[model samples]
Target: MSRLAIAAAAGLAALALGTAGASAQTVVSKIKDRGYVVCSGSQGVPGLSRPDEQGVWRGFDTDICRAFAVAILGDREKIRFVPLNAAQRLPAVQTGEIDFLSRTSTITYSRDTAVRFVAITLYDNDGLLVRKASNITDKKQLDGLTVCLQGGGSLTEKAVLETEEEFGIEMKKVYFDATIQARDAYFAGRCDSYVTDGTAAAGQRATVAKNPAEHDIIVIGKGTEPNGVAIAYGDDQLFNVVRWTFNALLWAESKGITQANIDEKLASGDAEISRVLGQEAGFGKAIGLDDKWAYNVIKQVGNYAEIWDRNLGANSPLKVPRGMNALYRDGGVNFPFPWD
Candidate 1:
């Protein structure tokens, strides 16, 4: 073969490889090109994620979606919510039916192997909610009682089993496919109690109870649930985008940057806050975004504390304590990564 012909063939092969590489887009780019994020959240779990009477979605999970939307698309409203039950959430994520799962899903070893759990947004625990009229103050008093759960294959169901084993008592179990179904059955007097994570149990009692005062949440086990956002595994760039976007929320909260004061923060004399707000330029560009990406997220969704206050804090119906969800310096598990 002629030298000219060989050189031409090599050039064409290089061009083809370059084109293919360019076409293999990241999740962030796909979301941007589609003009919105398709996020999967809970099916009307109040304080965690639910739509109001006005059809506006709001909650801790929804706020995470909004923060992600703002970080990637630069517009908080550039996101759509899809509600899924416990049985359906992981499948939807694996099949790409949703771009990201922001529901109150517990991160576990099995799930981590199947999908990437970016960061823990809320630390949770398994617990039971019983009717106050029953006077059930202790878990031992309810031994052998009927309990309604989403299903046995899920984390909540497993937690129930583990609790029974730990307490050395057997509780009769009834299973359902959706949280709403089990919750309805419990409300209708079909079961003695409903099993779920502590945060969700509080949310259910507050949002769905006809008489909120008639229910009491019985804490079963004592440990962190480490619930987090889930995305498809094997995409390092996309994982970093999510992990650090969440980290930015923690970082902003630690630095005292709130939605109301983001603009002021952008012009502050502090080098760290200025860099975080994108006054200095390396943070966003490293994550395949513009310099103001973190700024947009904070300005739109506020920081971790602000989100918690709006959705699950004292003013909300659930009124869940920050507990392990607080910043590390403030006695919680949230420790933001250094932007430097």
Candidate 2:
């Protein structure tokens, strides 16, 4: 062949290879190549995502990570939890250091556009936690009181400033690195109040102190905030996997489904149950996952209510009552998207 003809042939071969590569490449493809999904969790937040003495990870955030793992890898243990600090969480997801982040991250406009949050696994609101002895029942009572907060973050700092301005409350902001330290400072009388998410306040109160109830921690005011998991932007397939996994959890809970009842439901041959478990027609194919992806999540990680009650229930240290987090059927805001 002539030199020009040879060059043209090579270009055609390269074009074919590029097309084939593009066709094969997908979020699930890359995730499988890595062997395990990289999940970002907190460095140490007791009931959210913290390591136990035996190095086993548990809590609501950990469960969220496990749910994603089961959805993709068909095993809850097929994830490596990357414990991240508050500042490192968003950066880690943005840089692709982790496949998904379950680190009690709030879904803010900036983060959604920048880092891309999937479905909100947990919905949370900001509230103040004040020591009962301070005689603070409401925001007005916080006037002239020193409130300890996790400093340097634009979100928390702005919330504190807004609280001060809106409520006409004078608050001295004492910065701390972690909630544990802040809670200690508040208990030790270094600060009169601790301002954080209501869920976090409950967790801190439960984990620290000899008897959590002995020190009356009051939730002063609630703010409108949506907290959830975050993943990288532009990967629609991965986003669908994450979003559907969360919805599956809520859907299962709404339908009175549990790990124990899952097998029974599958065997019962109910059309809705069959569709969810992927025993009939599978919905996972639409999301680029195995037919039983949702089944794996429910079987391994349980549902939304199960996760919440396990971590923040009365028996758990946090003892957080399911207020706004209750299912929509129970008159709360938690409504699962339709599976069909």
Report the number of the highest-lDDT candidate: 1
Worst 10 residues of 2 by lDDT: 214-223
- Backbone clash pairs in model 1 (N, Cα, C under 3 Å; residues 3+ apart or in different chains), count: 0
**Ten-residue segment with the worst summed lDDT in candidate 1?**
18-27
Clash pairs, model 1 backbone: none
User: lDDT per model, in order?
Assistant: 0.85, 0.79
For model 1, how does the per-residue alpha-carbon lDDT over 229-327 read when each residue is reduced to its tens digit? Answer: 999876666787888899889888888889899888777788888877777756676677778888889988989999998899987988999888888
For candidate 1, the TM-score is 0.91
What lDDT would candidate 2 get against the real structure? 0.79
lDDT tens per residue, model 2, 1-340: 9999999999999998975575366556787877788888786777888888999898888898899888888988888888887778888888889988888788887778889887776666665666666775677777788888787573656667777787887788899887557767877879887777767767877886566765555444435667787888767678788888898999999888898889987888678888878876556777768889888888888888889888887658787788778887797789888865
Candidate 2 lands at a TM-score of 0.88
Where model 1 places Cα greater than 4 Å from the true spot, the runs are: 1-24
Per-model TM-score, in order, reads 0.91, 0.88
